[model samples]
Target: MLKVQEIRELIKLVDQSNLDEFVYEFDDCKIKMKKHKTETVAVSVPQISTQAVDLAPQATAVEAAAVKQEVEEVKEAPAPEVKESSTTENLHKITSPMVGTFYEASSPDAEPYVKVGSKVSTDSIVCIVEAMKLFNEIEAEVKGEIVEILVKNGQLVEYGQPLFLVKPE
Candidate 1:
Protein backbone atom coordinates (compact mmCIF):
# COMPACT_ATOMS: atom_id res chain seq x y z
CA MET A 1 0.00 0.00 0.00
CA LEU A 2 1.28 3.45 -0.86
CA LYS A 3 1.40 6.10 1.86
CA VAL A 4 -0.68 9.24 1.52
CA GLN A 5 2.46 11.38 1.56
CA GLU A 6 3.91 9.39 -1.35
CA ILE A 7 0.72 9.91 -3.36
CA ARG A 8 0.84 13.67 -2.68
CA GLU A 9 4.49 13.81 -3.79
CA LEU A 10 3.63 12.02 -7.02
CA ILE A 11 0.84 14.51 -7.72
CA LYS A 12 3.22 17.41 -7.11
CA LEU A 13 5.78 15.93 -9.49
CA VAL A 14 3.22 15.49 -12.25
CA ASP A 15 1.97 19.07 -11.75
CA GLN A 16 5.48 20.51 -12.11
CA SER A 17 6.30 18.38 -15.13
CA ASN A 18 4.81 18.61 -18.60
CA LEU A 19 3.52 15.03 -18.58
CA ASP A 20 -0.21 14.68 -19.04
CA GLU A 21 -0.57 11.26 -17.48
CA PHE A 22 1.50 9.17 -15.05
CA VAL A 23 1.00 5.55 -13.99
CA TYR A 24 2.74 3.37 -11.42
CA GLU A 25 2.10 -0.33 -10.82
CA PHE A 26 3.40 -2.52 -8.00
CA ASP A 27 2.40 -6.11 -7.26
CA ASP A 28 -1.36 -5.72 -6.66
CA CYS A 29 -1.52 -1.93 -6.38
CA LYS A 30 -1.86 0.48 -9.30
CA ILE A 31 -1.77 4.26 -9.13
CA LYS A 32 -2.73 6.56 -11.97
CA MET A 33 -2.73 10.35 -12.10
CA LYS A 34 -4.28 12.57 -14.76
CA LYS A 35 -4.15 16.33 -15.08
CA HIS A 36 -7.13 18.35 -16.23
CA LYS A 37 -7.58 21.90 -17.52
CA THR A 38 -9.36 23.02 -14.35
CA GLU A 39 -6.08 22.67 -12.41
CA THR A 40 -7.42 19.51 -10.79
CA VAL A 41 -5.46 16.27 -10.78
CA ALA A 42 -7.43 13.04 -10.49
CA VAL A 43 -5.86 10.07 -8.76
CA SER A 44 -7.07 6.53 -9.31
CA VAL A 45 -6.14 3.70 -6.96
CA PRO A 46 -7.37 0.16 -7.53
CA GLN A 47 -8.73 -1.71 -4.59
CA ILE A 48 -6.22 -4.03 -2.93
CA SER A 49 -7.50 -7.28 -1.50
CA THR A 50 -4.58 -7.86 0.87
CA GLN A 51 -5.37 -5.11 3.41
CA ALA A 52 -7.45 -1.98 3.75
CA VAL A 53 -5.41 1.20 3.57
CA ASP A 54 -7.28 3.89 5.43
CA LEU A 55 -6.23 7.06 3.68
CA ALA A 56 -8.91 9.21 5.32
CA PRO A 57 -11.58 8.61 7.87
CA GLN A 58 -15.10 8.46 6.50
CA ALA A 59 -17.21 11.44 7.53
CA THR A 60 -20.17 10.73 9.80
CA ALA A 61 -23.69 11.75 8.83
CA VAL A 62 -23.85 14.29 11.68
CA GLU A 63 -20.53 15.83 10.68
CA ALA A 64 -21.62 16.03 7.02
CA ALA A 65 -24.83 17.79 8.04
CA ALA A 66 -22.86 20.28 10.14
CA VAL A 67 -20.57 21.06 7.22
CA LYS A 68 -23.55 21.71 4.95
CA GLN A 69 -25.03 24.09 7.51
CA GLU A 70 -21.73 25.96 7.77
CA VAL A 71 -21.61 26.36 3.99
CA GLU A 72 -25.09 27.92 4.03
CA GLU A 73 -24.09 30.31 6.81
CA VAL A 74 -20.99 31.41 4.84
CA LYS A 75 -23.14 32.13 1.76
CA GLU A 76 -25.12 34.73 3.71
CA ALA A 77 -21.97 36.59 4.83
CA PRO A 78 -20.99 39.85 3.08
CA ALA A 79 -18.00 39.96 0.77
CA PRO A 80 -14.79 41.48 2.11
CA GLU A 81 -13.56 44.82 0.79
CA VAL A 82 -10.56 44.89 -1.54
CA LYS A 83 -8.23 47.87 -1.31
CA GLU A 84 -6.58 49.20 -4.48
CA SER A 85 -3.21 50.93 -4.38
CA SER A 86 -3.38 54.41 -5.98
CA THR A 87 0.41 54.80 -6.05
CA THR A 88 0.79 51.92 -8.50
CA GLU A 89 -1.62 53.47 -11.01
CA ASN A 90 1.22 54.62 -13.26
CA LEU A 91 3.73 51.94 -12.23
CA HIS A 92 4.62 48.71 -13.95
CA LYS A 93 4.56 45.55 -11.89
CA ILE A 94 7.06 42.70 -12.12
CA THR A 95 4.97 39.57 -11.51
CA SER A 96 5.99 36.00 -10.82
CA PRO A 97 5.79 33.60 -13.76
CA MET A 98 5.26 30.48 -11.66
CA VAL A 99 4.49 29.25 -8.17
CA GLY A 100 7.76 29.07 -6.25
CA THR A 101 10.01 30.49 -3.60
CA PHE A 102 11.24 34.01 -4.45
CA TYR A 103 14.94 34.81 -4.13
CA GLU A 104 16.32 38.34 -4.11
CA ALA A 105 19.81 37.13 -5.02
CA SER A 106 21.39 34.17 -6.76
CA SER A 107 22.77 33.04 -3.42
CA PRO A 108 22.38 34.05 0.21
CA ASP A 109 25.80 35.70 0.34
CA ALA A 110 25.39 37.55 -2.97
CA GLU A 111 24.00 41.06 -3.31
CA PRO A 112 20.39 41.36 -4.47
CA TYR A 113 19.86 41.56 -8.23
CA VAL A 114 17.68 44.68 -7.90
CA LYS A 115 16.51 46.97 -5.14
CA VAL A 116 14.32 50.01 -4.69
CA GLY A 117 15.53 52.97 -6.78
CA SER A 118 17.53 50.60 -9.05
CA LYS A 119 17.34 51.33 -12.77
CA VAL A 120 16.28 48.44 -14.97
CA SER A 121 15.74 47.63 -18.65
CA THR A 122 13.44 45.13 -20.30
CA ASP A 123 16.11 42.42 -20.19
CA SER A 124 17.26 43.08 -16.64
CA ILE A 125 16.82 40.25 -14.13
CA VAL A 126 14.90 41.45 -11.12
CA CYS A 127 14.85 38.27 -9.10
CA ILE A 128 14.87 34.47 -9.16
CA VAL A 129 11.99 32.08 -8.51
CA GLU A 130 12.86 28.51 -7.48
CA ALA A 131 10.30 25.96 -8.69
CA MET A 132 10.83 22.21 -8.35
CA LYS A 133 14.52 22.75 -7.51
CA LEU A 134 15.03 24.80 -10.70
CA PHE A 135 16.04 28.42 -10.24
CA ASN A 136 14.49 30.64 -12.94
CA GLU A 137 15.64 34.23 -13.39
CA ILE A 138 12.70 36.67 -13.59
CA GLU A 139 13.08 39.65 -15.96
CA ALA A 140 11.91 43.19 -15.32
CA GLU A 141 10.12 43.11 -18.71
CA VAL A 142 9.79 46.92 -18.75
CA LYS A 143 12.34 49.69 -18.94
CA GLY A 144 11.98 51.41 -15.60
CA GLU A 145 13.32 52.21 -12.16
CA ILE A 146 12.22 49.92 -9.33
CA VAL A 147 10.18 51.98 -6.89
CA GLU A 148 9.09 49.24 -4.48
CA ILE A 149 9.80 45.59 -3.73
CA LEU A 150 6.52 43.81 -3.02
CA VAL A 151 7.92 40.43 -2.05
CA LYS A 152 10.70 39.64 0.43
CA ASN A 153 13.61 37.22 -0.11
CA GLY A 154 12.79 33.50 0.28
CA GLN A 155 9.04 34.15 0.26
CA LEU A 156 6.63 31.83 -1.50
CA VAL A 157 4.91 33.58 -4.44
CA GLU A 158 2.11 32.47 -6.69
CA TYR A 159 1.73 32.91 -10.43
CA GLY A 160 0.97 36.55 -11.40
CA GLN A 161 1.81 37.78 -7.91
CA PRO A 162 3.49 41.18 -8.03
CA LEU A 163 7.11 41.02 -6.93
CA PHE A 164 8.17 44.59 -7.59
CA LEU A 165 6.66 47.91 -8.67
CA VAL A 166 8.56 50.00 -11.24
CA LYS A 167 8.12 53.48 -12.69
CA PRO A 168 8.53 53.18 -16.48
CA GLU A 169 11.14 55.39 -18.09
Candidate 2:
Protein backbone atom coordinates (compact mmCIF):
# COMPACT_ATOMS: atom_id res chain seq x y z
CA MET A 1 0.00 0.00 0.00
CA LEU A 2 1.22 3.47 -0.83
CA LYS A 3 1.55 5.94 2.00
CA VAL A 4 -0.62 9.09 2.00
CA GLN A 5 2.38 11.24 1.18
CA GLU A 6 3.27 9.01 -1.74
CA ILE A 7 -0.18 9.47 -3.23
CA ARG A 8 -0.11 13.21 -2.62
CA GLU A 9 3.29 13.49 -4.28
CA LEU A 10 2.00 11.57 -7.27
CA ILE A 11 -0.95 13.92 -7.59
CA LYS A 12 1.33 16.93 -7.37
CA LEU A 13 3.64 15.52 -9.98
CA VAL A 14 0.75 14.79 -12.33
CA ASP A 15 -0.50 18.34 -12.01
CA GLN A 16 2.91 19.88 -12.60
CA SER A 17 3.95 17.76 -15.54
CA ASN A 18 2.86 18.03 -19.18
CA LEU A 19 1.99 14.35 -19.44
CA ASP A 20 -1.66 13.52 -20.11
CA GLU A 21 -1.60 10.00 -18.76
CA PHE A 22 0.04 8.35 -15.77
CA VAL A 23 -0.02 4.86 -14.34
CA TYR A 24 1.31 3.46 -11.09
CA GLU A 25 1.51 -0.21 -10.20
CA PHE A 26 2.21 -1.92 -6.91
CA ASP A 27 2.53 -5.53 -5.86
CA ASP A 28 -1.04 -5.49 -4.53
CA CYS A 29 -2.66 -2.52 -6.30
CA LYS A 30 -2.81 -0.55 -9.54
CA ILE A 31 -3.80 3.10 -10.34
CA LYS A 32 -4.52 4.19 -13.90
CA MET A 33 -5.04 7.75 -15.06
CA LYS A 34 -5.94 10.11 -17.92
CA LYS A 35 -6.63 13.80 -18.27
CA HIS A 36 -10.25 14.91 -18.01
CA LYS A 37 -11.03 17.15 -20.97
CA THR A 38 -13.08 19.39 -18.70
CA GLU A 39 -10.41 19.50 -16.01
CA THR A 40 -6.63 19.62 -15.94
CA VAL A 41 -6.37 16.41 -13.92
CA ALA A 42 -8.65 13.45 -13.40
CA VAL A 43 -8.27 10.58 -10.98
CA SER A 44 -9.77 7.15 -11.55
CA VAL A 45 -9.09 5.08 -8.45
CA PRO A 46 -9.62 1.36 -8.00
CA GLN A 47 -8.42 -0.42 -4.90
CA ILE A 48 -8.34 -4.20 -5.07
CA SER A 49 -7.46 -5.38 -1.63
CA THR A 50 -7.83 -9.14 -1.42
CA GLN A 51 -9.59 -8.69 1.91
CA ALA A 52 -12.43 -6.64 0.39
CA VAL A 53 -13.26 -9.39 -2.12
CA ASP A 54 -13.24 -12.00 0.63
CA LEU A 55 -15.69 -10.06 2.79
CA ALA A 56 -19.08 -11.73 2.74
CA PRO A 57 -22.19 -9.57 2.59
CA GLN A 58 -23.72 -11.47 5.45
CA ALA A 59 -20.71 -10.71 7.62
CA THR A 60 -21.64 -9.20 10.96
CA ALA A 61 -20.72 -5.71 12.03
CA VAL A 62 -17.98 -7.13 14.17
CA GLU A 63 -16.65 -9.08 11.21
CA ALA A 64 -16.64 -6.06 8.93
CA ALA A 65 -14.80 -4.04 11.56
CA ALA A 66 -12.32 -6.81 12.02
CA VAL A 67 -11.57 -6.86 8.34
CA LYS A 68 -11.23 -3.09 8.30
CA GLN A 69 -8.90 -3.20 11.26
CA GLU A 70 -6.72 -5.84 9.66
CA VAL A 71 -6.49 -3.83 6.43
CA GLU A 72 -5.66 -0.70 8.41
CA GLU A 73 -2.89 -2.52 10.21
CA VAL A 74 -1.37 -3.61 6.92
CA LYS A 75 -1.91 -0.35 5.03
CA GLU A 76 -1.33 2.49 7.43
CA ALA A 77 2.37 3.24 7.62
CA PRO A 78 4.11 6.45 8.64
CA ALA A 79 4.21 8.70 5.60
CA PRO A 80 7.26 10.73 4.77
CA GLU A 81 7.09 14.44 5.55
CA VAL A 82 6.24 16.46 2.43
CA LYS A 83 8.11 19.69 1.97
CA GLU A 84 5.30 22.20 1.80
CA SER A 85 5.73 25.67 0.44
CA SER A 86 5.57 28.71 2.71
CA THR A 87 1.97 29.03 1.55
CA THR A 88 1.33 25.49 2.71
CA GLU A 89 1.99 26.65 6.23
CA ASN A 90 -1.24 28.57 5.85
CA LEU A 91 -3.18 25.55 4.61
CA HIS A 92 -5.65 24.06 7.04
CA LYS A 93 -6.30 20.37 7.40
CA ILE A 94 -9.75 18.80 7.35
CA THR A 95 -9.64 15.82 9.68
CA SER A 96 -11.96 12.90 10.19
CA PRO A 97 -14.38 13.35 13.06
CA MET A 98 -14.75 9.62 13.70
CA VAL A 99 -13.21 6.25 13.01
CA GLY A 100 -15.01 4.58 10.13
CA THR A 101 -14.83 3.70 6.43
CA PHE A 102 -13.90 6.92 4.64
CA TYR A 103 -15.69 7.48 1.36
CA GLU A 104 -15.25 10.27 -1.17
CA ALA A 105 -18.85 10.00 -2.36
CA SER A 106 -22.28 8.92 -1.23
CA SER A 107 -22.06 5.77 -3.30
CA PRO A 108 -19.76 3.95 -5.67
CA ASP A 109 -21.46 5.40 -8.78
CA ALA A 110 -21.55 8.98 -7.58
CA GLU A 111 -19.13 11.77 -8.30
CA PRO A 112 -16.84 12.76 -5.46
CA TYR A 113 -18.00 15.52 -3.13
CA VAL A 114 -14.92 17.57 -3.86
CA LYS A 115 -11.82 17.40 -6.04
CA VAL A 116 -8.49 19.10 -6.26
CA GLY A 117 -8.93 22.77 -7.21
CA SER A 118 -12.61 22.63 -6.33
CA LYS A 119 -13.80 25.59 -4.34
CA VAL A 120 -16.02 24.81 -1.37
CA SER A 121 -17.73 26.41 1.54
CA THR A 122 -17.73 25.50 5.20
CA ASP A 123 -21.18 23.91 4.98
CA SER A 124 -20.36 21.66 2.04
CA ILE A 125 -20.30 17.91 2.59
CA VAL A 126 -16.78 16.93 1.74
CA CYS A 127 -17.08 13.20 2.22
CA ILE A 128 -18.99 10.34 3.80
CA VAL A 129 -17.88 7.90 6.49
CA GLU A 130 -20.01 4.83 7.15
CA ALA A 131 -20.02 3.24 10.60
CA MET A 132 -22.37 0.67 12.11
CA LYS A 133 -24.56 0.78 8.99
CA LEU A 134 -25.01 4.52 9.40
CA PHE A 135 -23.67 6.83 6.72
CA ASN A 136 -22.20 10.02 8.10
CA GLU A 137 -21.73 13.08 5.90
CA ILE A 138 -18.53 14.85 6.84
CA GLU A 139 -18.57 18.60 6.32
CA ALA A 140 -15.84 21.03 5.45
CA GLU A 141 -15.02 22.92 8.61
CA VAL A 142 -13.36 25.69 6.64
CA LYS A 143 -14.05 27.40 3.34
CA GLY A 144 -11.21 27.05 0.88
CA GLU A 145 -9.94 25.48 -2.30
CA ILE A 146 -9.32 21.74 -2.06
CA VAL A 147 -5.60 21.42 -2.53
CA GLU A 148 -5.42 17.70 -1.93
CA ILE A 149 -7.43 14.63 -0.96
CA LEU A 150 -5.35 12.61 1.48
CA VAL A 151 -7.54 9.51 1.55
CA LYS A 152 -9.16 7.62 -1.29
CA ASN A 153 -12.72 6.39 -1.73
CA GLY A 154 -13.75 3.35 0.35
CA GLN A 155 -10.60 3.69 2.42
CA LEU A 156 -10.75 2.75 6.07
CA VAL A 157 -9.78 5.80 8.01
CA GLU A 158 -9.16 6.41 11.69
CA TYR A 159 -10.19 9.22 14.00
CA GLY A 160 -8.45 12.55 13.43
CA GLN A 161 -6.95 11.37 10.15
CA PRO A 162 -6.15 14.13 7.70
CA LEU A 163 -8.73 13.84 4.96
CA PHE A 164 -8.08 16.96 2.92
CA LEU A 165 -5.75 19.92 2.77
CA VAL A 166 -7.35 23.30 1.96
CA LYS A 167 -5.87 26.56 0.94
CA PRO A 168 -8.14 29.16 2.51
CA GLU A 169 -8.99 32.02 0.21
Best by TM-score: 1
Residue pairs with backbone atoms closer than 3 Å in model 1 (clashes): none
- Predicted candidate 1 versus true structure: per-residue lDDT over 12-42, tens digit per residue: 4565567767777765555566654333365
In candidate 2, which residue ranges exceed 4 Å CA deviation? 1-87
Candidate 1 off by > 4 Å:
1-83
Backbone steric clashes in candidate 1, count:
0
**Residue 165 of model 2: what lDDT?**
92
* Clashing pairs for predicted structure model 2, backbone only: none
lDDT of 2 by residue, 1-169 (tens): 5443344345444534566677776554454544443433644222223233333345567755664565454434443234457876889888877666788888889999999999989999999988656899998888889998888788756667788999987
Clashes of each: 0, 0
- Which 10 successive residues of model 1 have the least lDDT summed? 46-55
